[model samples]
Target: MHRIIFATGNEGKMKEIRMILKDLDCQVLSMKEAGIEADIVEDGTTFEENAIIKAKAIMELSGNIVLADDSGLEVDAMDKAPGVYSARFMGEDTSYDIKNNYILEQLKGLPEEKRSARFVSVIACAFPDGRIFTTRGVFEGFIGDKISGENGFGYDPIFWVPEFGCTSAELPPEVKNAVSHRGKALGSMKEKLKEML
Candidate 1:
């Protein structure tokens, strides 16, 4: 079987990716599991660009099907202030509690409609033979006033999905994976991956 390498050190992200691509008839290994430690700087201005950068960077070393993703929360009220900067909204080392609080503060007093936001994820798959494929996914919802649940990472705690009537973090793993931006992107890439493999 072919090997698929997810280029990330974040445990949450690694787990999510594995779950998204679990059915593939190949090995899904994180960078650490694949025995690679490369500092990939994310300086791109867009999600797709960042994902491509990481995927290409890792593909050089992994020599396997390297998968990378760049995702963030884009709030309409904030004019998408945290679109590409979601991960570093309150500095790289700040806690998600602070991040969630900051978002709540920004949307204070605003109605749910104005609090509309979306989570965007761009996933890139790069092969050792120079073939690269990318897919994008967006989760539409509003930001909640309070952080609820601890099921997901990043802005999940504050992202409220109207369809689900709850925060993304509150949804079960299977449910979240079916509606999450990462899930959408990974799902869209499933056929491509099958063909590639």
Candidate 2:
């Protein structure tokens, strides 16, 4: 089976990726699992650009198929203030509790409709032969007034799913994987990999 390195140190994301792509005929490994260590700078202004940057950077070092995803929460109320900077929103070291609370405080008085937000995931797969494939997935929802779920990471607890009448974090892993932004993106990427592999 071909070895594929996913460029991310976040275990939460790794779990989701592994679960979604488990049926693929390839070995999916994290950068650390593949013995890759580097400070890749994601200077792109958009999710797609950032994903490409990381994928290409890792592929250059490993000479293997590298996958990277840049995802974030875009809130319409905040005019997408933390779109590309979601990880660094309240500062890189700040906890998500603080970040989630801060967002809640910002939209305290606003109605649910005004708290519109969406999660975006852009996946980029870079081959050793200098070819790159990209896919995007977006999950639409409004922001909840409080952090409510424990099953998800990042901004998931605050992302309300209107269709489910709950937060994204509240959904089960199987359910979330079937409807999440990362799941959707990874699902699409899996098809591309099936053809390429």
Candidate 3:
């Protein structure tokens, strides 16, 4: 099987990607497993740029195919704030709980209808020949009044799905994968991979 290195240390993301790509003819390996720990600076203004930066950095270091993703919650009420900086919204070292709490406090007392938000994911794949490919996916929803689940990382708990009557974090793996931004992006990438290989 072809081996592709994913440039992320987040185990949750790693697990999700593995599940999404399980049926493919390639094996996805995390940077840690690939013995790569280089920290690529994410100074780009957009998610796509940041994802490309990461993937390219890893490809250069390992000289292997690499995929990197940059995803975040964009709140309409906040004017799309915490977009690229979602992970470091509170601070570089802030815990998920603290970040979640901060977001909740910011949206406190806002009307439910005005609490619109969406999760955006951009995945970039870099090849050893300096070729790059990218795909984007978005999951539209509103922020809940309060945190509701404990299964997911980042802002999953506050991201409510009206049709499902639950937060993204409350959905089971299969359901979440069917509609999640990362899943959609990876699914599209898989099609591209099939064509390329």
RMSD of each: 0.9, 0.6, 0.8
As for candidate 2, its clashing pairs are: none
Number of the top-ranking candidate, with lDDT as the measure: 2
Every candidate's lDDT: 0.90, 0.95, 0.91
What TM-score fits each model?
Answer: 0.97, 0.99, 0.98
CA deviation > 4 Å runs, candidate 3: none
Tens digit of per-residue lDDT, candidate 1, span 1-197: 98888888899998788887888898888899999999888999999999999999999987888999899999999999799888888899999899889889989999888998999999999999999989999999999989998998888999888898999999999999999999999999887888767
Which candidate, 2 or 3, would have the higher lDDT against the true structure?
A: 2
Give a tens-digit lDDT track for model 2, residues 123-192: 9999999999999999999999889999999999999999999999999999999999999999999999
**How are the candidates ranked when ordered by lDDT, highest leading?**
2, 3, 1
Model 3: pairs clashing at backbone N, Cα or C within 3 Å: none
Q: How close is candidate 2 to the true structure, as a TM-score?
A: 0.99
* lDDT score for residue 2 of model 1: 87
